[model samples]
Target: MELVCIECGKARRPENLFPMSCECGGLLEVRHDFRRADAEKLRALFDSRLALRTGPYASGVWRYKELIDPEVEEAHIVTRGEGNTGLYDCAPAARYAGVRKVWLKAQGENPSGSFKDNGMTVAVSRGAAAGFRTLACASTGNTASSLAMYAAWAGLRCLVLVPPGGVADGKLAQTIAYGAEVYGIEGGYDIGVRLLNRYGEELGFYVCNSFNPFRIEGQKSIVIEAAHQLGWSLPDWIVLPGGALSNASALGKGLLEMKAIGLIDRVPRIAVVQAEGASPFHRMIASGGGELVPEPEPRTAASAIRIGNPPSWRKAARVLRECNGVTCAVSDGEIMAAKRVIDRSGIGCEPAAAAGLAGLKMLAEGGTIGRDETALVVLTGHLLKDADAIRMPVPGPALEPLAPDELLARLASVR
Candidate 1:
């Protein structure tokens, strides 16, 4: 494996255990030779592994270890049964979005209640194998919870930096419950990341942020598993909410790799949705793929995706362009409305996760996504991850004290 710069195309050996970026200020992506692996045999092996009940084979992410990092020993693998999230046939959600077929990939069921576990397990495992005693990350919420839990499992010290008053109570509670040293930074996620980079060398800590190539490698399993769950057939579109843009990049990379290795006949067109208040990627695409402009003070109720400057912008843009995808931003009102629809389906998600449904509706109405096409919307986090956002009174319901005979009369009068 080699660390290849998304821009400048500079290739180099990863000197550190967790490679961050290139000297040219570009993100690094893990490049492997998939031509050496037999596609049909690999698919057969993965399918066979599904019958096994234990070890890495059962893990949704590690089941495709050859496609991720084959060099890592089995002993170094730290898994919490992550990545076996369900793919539900959400007909209600489809109708809401004006699509014929819509499947909700509920990633929130993963260990730590978010999609971050898909990447954290691999990053922490690699860090432990590389002799790193401490693991660190700058997170808004989900990443911190994931890193803390994985670090605890791997027996490594975890340090998390979060923007003051920026994280949700549930996520912060998870991080603290996992015994991580949490710091409240005055600035936001980007500032925390900058500080981590400045101090990581002296502190000897492995950064578990999406900037790490190994994390992306692990996150690629989301698409891999989704394809396998779909009987090796690719969907017409894959919609997801964008935060750091790593998930978009990872899914696109995984789809392309599957096609390269003959496991899939075609790759899906990816749609990345962003909260309008924190929509740098959407703006970049809207501005004709120009240089990414950061939103210095991104304001959104979707705290998980309230990222002003996504580090993986270039890589995500490349994937979107290559896959012929689109990026769109939805207002907070739209996001909450979509959230209620998803909640009514009993597959509730965090506000950030609802952005996918919101964007799907926008794209469907705009004729970008066809009503007859098959699409998959990824719900990234669990409902409890942002329960505070859902505390509003339930619509169309009111309770009043009444005598038993009056209640019976009311019940009899209904219909």
Candidate 2:
């Protein structure tokens, strides 16, 4: 497998794959030799396992392994059977907002309870194949837990760097329980990023950041699976809570590949959703340049989405203009409200998950989506992953029924 520089169109072998862009500093995208005929030929690889009526992995994502080059071809995927998560048609959540057919891509079903499992499956799969003894990432929380969980499954050493006071106990517990070396950094996520990057280079550790092309390769299959789930039909739009921008960008690449293979006729407009407190890409959309505007100090309950400087900024911008898709930011209050709102609808999710739902609601109100349009809103991780970050109005423990003469009666009844 090889990649071509998107800038100079120069091809290089995978062995010489540079994790970041070259002298021009352009974000790299993989180039495949699979032309028209190969696209149609791609699905046959998983013909025996294809289950078209259900989730896409039952058909496309897992089927498109030819397009993705894993480092260890012979190594079994380190999935706790992560992919093929059930998609739900959220009737109650949709009815209140005049939404027609809102489907939730609940990635929370993954082993560590998040979509990070998808990328980790590929990361751990490749790391094992490539003979790497160590794997690491700098994360807000979920990615670290995912990396650690999958590394443990693959029997590889896992190193995690996270922001101090930014992570929730549930998240920290998950990572530590997986036996990863958890380092709580005094700085922010981006600072942790630089530290991890330099650390990877010095220690020869395989990085699991947004900058890693293979990690994105694992993400692309999400689009493939989504398409297959809809019986090879593409949705009108895919909404996601954007932080690193790799997820949306990779989804786009996956859709285009499917179209190249004639599996889908069109690409969905990929809308990137962000929390208003740290909407850096929203600023880029307003400024009319791919260059990210300086991000403001963040404040939001959606701590995982508090990314001021996303590394995949430029490519994310290209996707925005290319598809004419727009970026939308939702207020922290609305995100919190939506968290309650979704829970009321029996779909409990974190604030970042709520942010995506809020963004979708905003788009629907603004006529960005037609009432009949099919939409897939991704809830990236589980609410349990960061339950502590959400602010409740009042602290209350579980209550038993109050007696008529409560204080005295309860004292007698308590015994």
lDDT at 183, model 1 = 95
Error of 1 at 145 (Å): 0.5
Candidate lDDT values, in order = 0.91, 0.73
Provide TM-scores for the models.
0.95, 0.88
| Cα lDDT of model 1 by residue, 289-344, tens digit | 67999899999999999999998888899899889999999999999999999999
> lDDT tens string, model 2, 1-415?
5765666766676555445455565556666665644544555655555644543234233455665553335435555656676677887656644577777777776778877777777767766666778888988888899899888888899988888888778888999999999888766778777776656756878888777666777787666766656777766788888887878777777777677767787778888889888888887786776568747466567887887778777767767766667889999887877677666766677778777778878888889877777678888888787787566664465254566687677678768
Model 1: pairs clashing at backbone N, Cα or C within 3 Å: none
Winner by lDDT? 1
Question: Which residue runs of candidate 2 sit more than 4 Å off their true CA positions?
Answer: 17-19, 36-47, 50-61, 70-72, 389-415
lDDT of 1 at 389: 97
